[model samples]
Target: MSRSLQTLRRLALPAALAAALLAGLQAARATEAPVSLAAVALGEADYQRVNDALVQHHVVPRYQVMAAAMAALDAAAGRYCAAPGAGTLAALRAADEAAVDAWMGVQHLHFGPVELFMRSYRLYFWPQGRGRIAQATGELLAAADPASLEEQHFRNASTAIQGLPALEVLLYGEGAEETPSAFRCALLTRIACNMKAMAADIVEEWQGGKIDFARTVAEPGPDNPYFESAEEATLAFFQSLYNGLELISDARLKPVAGASIEKAKPALAESRAPGRSLRNVVVNLEALQGLYEGEGGPGLGDLAVRSGADPKLEPLLRKAFRLTVETAKGIEPPLAEAVVDPKRRKAVDKLLTQLVAIKQILRSRFSPATGLPIGFNAMDGD
Candidate 1:
């Protein structure tokens, strides 16, 4: 079988797994006590502090890391394309992994410049739409002209073949390292450069005063198109937090873990092709935790504490976050392999349970404590 087809076959599983798991969870959660935010009013100064801290400590730093990693990845791919060898290939793979890690750090910021120009999709076209990545990569490999796979050409290429998933197929798929075609190397180089350019643009947009995102978010007004009030801006960030958690639980874990132990399908895990699926989960939780606790700056946790909410709440939430990350670390490497092993399967199951607990705290405790309403749309699954 062709390498792309083999990769697809290795990754494919029943779609019903996510649907069934979400349905059961939603039904079970329906009977739980409803959470309501107290009418604790936050002033304009409070909003400014939170927004400034988020921009300086969380947003800019994460994007800067992503840009640096992508630049490193582009250079590594160029080197490998110039000198096709096992050592170069290994270095290229390491660069790819670093870029993925950095992307996960800022992946939850689903707003602002990152949402412009289909940039996010171009950076990482995942879930692949049922073998689209494989099919597109196959066609590109079969018919690619080294002269045509340039920066401008990639600008108009199919979204499926323009991102990290396609790169993963080329770098780690069967025999990719063994026989590196010139056309393949050129394609990899072009894609890597394209991704790096996009990352750099995002960082520039956020920090170079091109958009003034910090001012726009902190000083919301009728003139500002994105947010009309500090409350609205706060809600947007909270929704991002909630959405990130949901994506990990529903999109990443549910399909692989299934509704029961007997039906677990390990191959369906995200980034499984490179064995970083579990690592992605760990980084995601770390980012979310950082956002919650402010990472040494003002954050939602601080806002909650100053609002006369229980001081112990933040510590409790932090403990839950720690437990979730530690539990995920214990689940054997390459989540795909772990999900199928008997002992490891139990660990995977436990990790899912811990995630659910964290989600519950965010909804039941964090939202009410911070006086932010739970974003129902963020949790609702179709």
Candidate 2:
């Protein structure tokens, strides 16, 4: 076989493998459910689509690009090493350019799609993309041989990824401007705020980690420095929540709104610990559930109106509660098992069973009225 054909064959395997790995990652994300404190949280399907797009186009393509670029570089290096006198500076420069171009071509294909995903995420989980960008930028900065061919290739890659947020804004923001409705404006400003907040959070998390770069960026205060710097991200999350509130006109929305607004006020005004903020969010959800039950909408009317508790909101609450319990399950076995003894586990299981029963009750009682799923739009006025 010709040398070129041989190289092509070698390149094909790793490229295919990279694509397969990326596909698996996307599939896993698609199958998993989202963790949310509120009933009106962003849909799991949207998150999965954004994640899959990022992985398939940008992230997955990155592996193949890096691999191809490296292989080409290595091939050139082998020739140079074997006949050092024959390989001129011009020859090395030409080879390097070829590899960089190849890498950039891969990046070009992936960049726009990934940027769109990041923009969508900014509408919901703004910090996640920012975290990734922050981590990548730090790694790029910390590399020792910044000018070496390997480092140069990575530098190109890093810069490409870093450029995504701004590109997203430029592309999506301009369009949003032409038709600036409350929703568009809210979403655009939210995206902008999220980018900065996400970047700050990323820096804080990097600093928190044991990695050398993390130590270099370390701040003196707060358990989660990201949360401290994540004001805009936190605000944007709440703004989305506010938008959700506007969508529902139920009387129950008033208290849920009150509680959400109360919690959001603190987060927007000052930087608080993420743990505290998250706890407050859970409280808001629980409060919303209660207010929802009290509004004379459905189910024996507020677990209080009947001999037994109403189960209308129970299923949604149950899912949220289960997510919390399941998240805790990932803790070290000794800690988890100790914190949640067998009795506690049994209690949780029994509660989940009750939640299922609640779903049945709500479905039978309310489905006839709404002609929709039991939980769908059941909140008063929704």
User: For candidate 1, which ten residues in a row score worst on lDDT?
Assistant: 4-13
Q: What are the per-residue Cα lDDT tens digits for candidate 2 across 1-382?
A: 8533332233224335334434533453354313111222323333233223333333334434444544454455444434443343235334444433333323222122223434223312222433454354334334533332232242233332333332233222333124233332222223233333433333333334443222321221255432232222222222222222222211112222222222312222100211122222323333223222322333112222221122233443334334433333332322223223444334323322332333333344222222223334533465
> In each prediction, how many residue pairs overlap at the backbone (N, C-alpha, C within less than 3 A)?
0, 1
Instruction: Give lDDT tens digits, candidate 1, residues 1-382.
Output: 7532332232222243234434533553454324212324556667668877887898989999999999999999989888889899899999999999998898888887889888888888777577788788888889866656877878777888888888988987755867678788888988899999899988888875668677778679999999888767877777778788888888888898887767878778887778889999989988987887786688767776665444445665666677677778888887777777778877777777767666766775567666678866744665
TM-score of structure candidate 2? 0.23
RMSD of each: 9.2, 25.9
Cα lDDT for residue 122, candidate 2: 32
Stretches of candidate 1 off by over 4 Å are 1-39, 146-148, 375-382
Question: For candidate 2, which ten residues in a row score worst on lDDT?
Answer: 266-275
List per-prediction Cα lDDT, in the order shown: 0.77, 0.31
Model 1, C-alpha of 180: deviation from truth (Å): 2.2
